[model samples]
Target: MGELKLMKGNEVIAEAAIRCGCDGYFGYPITPQSEIMEYLALREPWKETGMVFLQAESEVAAINMIYGGASCGKRVMTTSSSPGMSLMMEGLSYIAGAELPCVIVNIVRGGPGLGTIQPSQADYNQATKGGGHGDYQSIVLAPATVQEMYDFVELSFDLAFKYRIPAIILSDGVIGQMMEKVTLGEFKPRWTAEQIEQMSGSWATTGMKGRKMNVTTSLRLQSEDLEKHNNNLQAKYRTIEKEEVRFDEYMTDDAEYILVAYGSSARICHKTVELAREKGLKVGLLRPITVWPYPTKRLQELAQKAKGMMAVEMSAGQMFIDLKLAVNGKTPVEYYGRMGGMVPSPSEVLGALEKQLIGGANNE
Candidate 1:
């Protein structure tokens, strides 16, 4: 173990970035996640690790800065809230089209417009289903605990580099502001120029140097070529779906009812499971760690065994659609949510579970 300390989720992100050898961070200050940039500035990783931490004028500029850094095979990232993330959607699309690897963290807040600063999981569709234009899917990770918030930052970078695509940490305000003990990882040195050439020279823009020039662009004026490129991207996504689906199942083997959730909502569902079990109900919690891959296979298998399922969220049930698709009518999947930054209490969630999943109320 490297070190043990209690840290908030946003601060852990900045610490993890430096320890993971991230090259740069470009982001604007946003509520519930401003600590990410503030901590970076306080730590001064630029002096210690040669990492560049720049506070951009806007989220739009921040994401584009990541695009530039990533194109050169540098490990770059940015952090934002719901509205700020909305501003970066165009840049996110360009990064996807160019197939550059980078990490983006969204500490989501209530949405639709400049909504409340409180936590919300309303950005599920925006993060997973191509928030920007064109056909693209970013690998999305949901971290429920402070420890996971630390772990996933490093994991996101690793996955991004491996796939040459963007990876998103789809966290919420509760997780961002919450504090817990975390076991920090060992420090890894940033990659050198030679290392970049050796590892990413094939596709990265590292100054031509005795080889044919490389162009990184999403633009394909030829229709046939564009189709081919799109097909290739789809193939990669399929492979990722097959290989990278991850979730956590608690007390599911003998579960009569299953609760499906992710991020902070999953934590609440865990308490609901324990409460239900205490009342002689065999309930399980299925928490999706990778929201994009969706863990549909595990859900399908569990659906066959459980009598009913409830999709709990802080939003108006955005992930409910995915749960229904995974169940595919084999079992009743009901939605229980509190929108506009309101989180359902454990008692409220248990009550909904009893009414919706146990009492056999009409699931609509």
Candidate 2:
């Protein structure tokens, strides 16, 4: 075990990055997520762990800095809110195209041109469907609690390096601002240059060092070469889909109806599950931890037995599309959401489920 302490979600992200042996953090400050960089600035891990922390002038600069660091096989990361993320999209595409391994955290707020500083999950489509232009995908992890907010940073780094791709921690303002007790993981020493060379020797642009000069770029002027590169990328994505789908289920054994959700909304829906069960409503909850490599297989199986499913979100039904596809029309799917930075309570969610799924089905 390690140190146990109560900390805010953004603070733990900074501490967890340090403990996970991250080489550097390059990010700009944005509302609902500015605390992440603020915490790092206050902690000043440069003196403690030799970690590099830079407050970039803009989100664009931060993401490009990530590209440079990751090219050297360093564990680099960046965090931002919705507008800031919009600024980073092109850089994100470049990083993905170059196949660099780095972690990016998006503590999402209400969107569509600075909608609100409060929480919203509207970025669900943006994160899972590759906000950047191209056929690439990032491993998108949705953390529902403060503990998960800390734990997923390390997991995101692990998966990013393992697959040689960018990984994203897709969180919302609620989780980012919440505080909870977390058991800190044991500190890990930053990797030495020699260790980086040994681990990433295959393609990392460390140096010539008596070998062929390594080149890392996404440019393939030749159409044939670009197509071949895309094929390789697709193959990698398939492997990830096969191995990385992660989700959690509650009270699903004899569930007649199901609720699908992620991130902060999932937390509310958990209580909704308990409340429904109290009313003798056989309702279960499916929370997708990784929203990109979604739990489609499990949802498909559940669809065969479930009378209906309702997707609860903080957006105007973005993830609802994925849920409908996952069930493949085997069962009726409904959507309930609150937009413009509004968060629905557990009772409200249960009421939506009752009105949209249960009562509607009974009427039929």
Candidate with best TM-score = 1
Residues 134-224 of candidate 2 have per-residue lDDT tens digits of 9889999999988898899999999999999999999989999999998899989999989998999777899989678888899999999
Q: Please report, as a residue range, the 10-residue window in candidate 1 with the lowest summed lDDT.
A: 355-364
- Name every residue pair that clashes in candidate 2: none
Q: Model 2 misses residue 115 by how many Å?
A: 0.8
- Pairs of colliding residues, candidate 1: none
Off by over 4 Å in 2: 361-364
Cα error, candidate 2, residue 204 (Å): 1.5
Cα lDDT listed for each candidate = 0.94, 0.93
Compose the digit string of candidate 1's lDDT tens values, residues 1-364.
Answer: 7799999999999999999999999999999799999999999999999999999999999999999999999999999999999999999999999999999999999988998999999999999998999999999999999999999989999899989889999999999999999999999999999999999998889899977787778999999999999999999999999999989999999998999999999999999999999999999999999999899999999989889999999888789999999899989899999989998888899999998879988554
